[model samples]
Target: MRVALELVKEGRAEACVSAGNTGALMGLAKLLLKPLEGIERPALVTVLPHQHKGKTVVLDLGANVDCDSTMLVQFAVMGAVLAEEVVGDQKSPGGVAQYRGRRNQRPRQYS
Candidate 1:
């Protein structure tokens, strides 16, 4: 995991994908790559196809399971930017961003 992250950091690779332990990957990434400035914790985000249409972005799947409001907002902003850039073109309409914390908790959504 460290080598994979190092490749990206050194510009040898664009990104790293892992099918190993989530905790291990996140731990190594945080230690090796470090979080961006002002980011309390780095999040793991995935893009999934929505049931109806378009794509849905889910974050912190295993990293930072208990995030604060500020962290949630940060994840939302990052997810929105990723969805817009990777899932759609600039002309596409922006979609909503939502954050659900813990099981059984109500979801907080934004446009």
Candidate 2:
């Protein structure tokens, strides 16, 4: 994990993905990559299968225990960017859309 982070720090890699120890990965990533400007915390986001046979992006599963509205907004923006850039049209098929989850309510989609 350290070596993978080092490669990212050295600009040899665009991103790093790991399935091991979420907390450790988050800590190491924060330490090595640093947060993007205006992004106070880096979110741990992943694409998951939705009931509609589509993919949904979820973030900060364990990286953050509690988040404020601002943090949530930041995560949403980051998720949207990831969906557009990383996931791409080939994977999405329906085009990139941002889905914001509300308390006790279904996710609201925005183009």
Candidate 3:
């Protein structure tokens, strides 16, 4: 994992995709590639198919066991950008939901 990440860090590779230990991948990515400015912690984002159409951008995926409000907002912004630029979606997703336990069904709004 470190070797793959090192290649990206040295510019020998553009990106490193891993299906290994999530914790180890996140840790090494932070150590080698570093997070972007204003990003408290890098998010592990992926695309998932929407039930009706298009796709959904999901993030965090155990990258951070807990996150403050600011971190949540950052993840939302990053997800939106990836959806727009990468996924080529003009409109944003339906909403951003905060997962807590299993009964929280409300979407989180940041002021």
**Top-scoring candidate (TM-score):** 3
Cα lDDT computed for each candidate against the true fold: 0.72, 0.71, 0.77
What would the per-residue lDDT of candidate 2 be over residues 1-106, giving only the tens digit for each residue?
8889899999999778887887888888878886656788787777887897667776666577656678877776677677777766245422222433444454
In model 2, what is the error at residue 87, expressed in angstroms? 1.6
Residue 20 Cα positional deviation in candidate 2, in Å, after optimal superposition? 4.2
TM-score, cand. 3 vs. native = 0.72
Per TM-score, what order, best first?
Answer: 3, 1, 2
Count of clashes in candidate 1: 0
Task: Tell me the TM-score of each prediction against the true structure.
Answer: 0.67, 0.64, 0.72
Lowest summed lDDT across 10 adjacent residues in model 2 is found at 92-101
After superposing candidate 2 on the true structure, give the runs of residues whose Cα lies further than 4 Å from its correct spot: 49-54, 89-111
Write out the backbone clash pairs for model 1. Answer: none
Off by over 4 Å in 3: 10-14, 101-111
13-102: candidate 3 lDDT, tens digit per residue: 877798799888887887878665777767888899989888888877667766777888888777877888888987875354546423
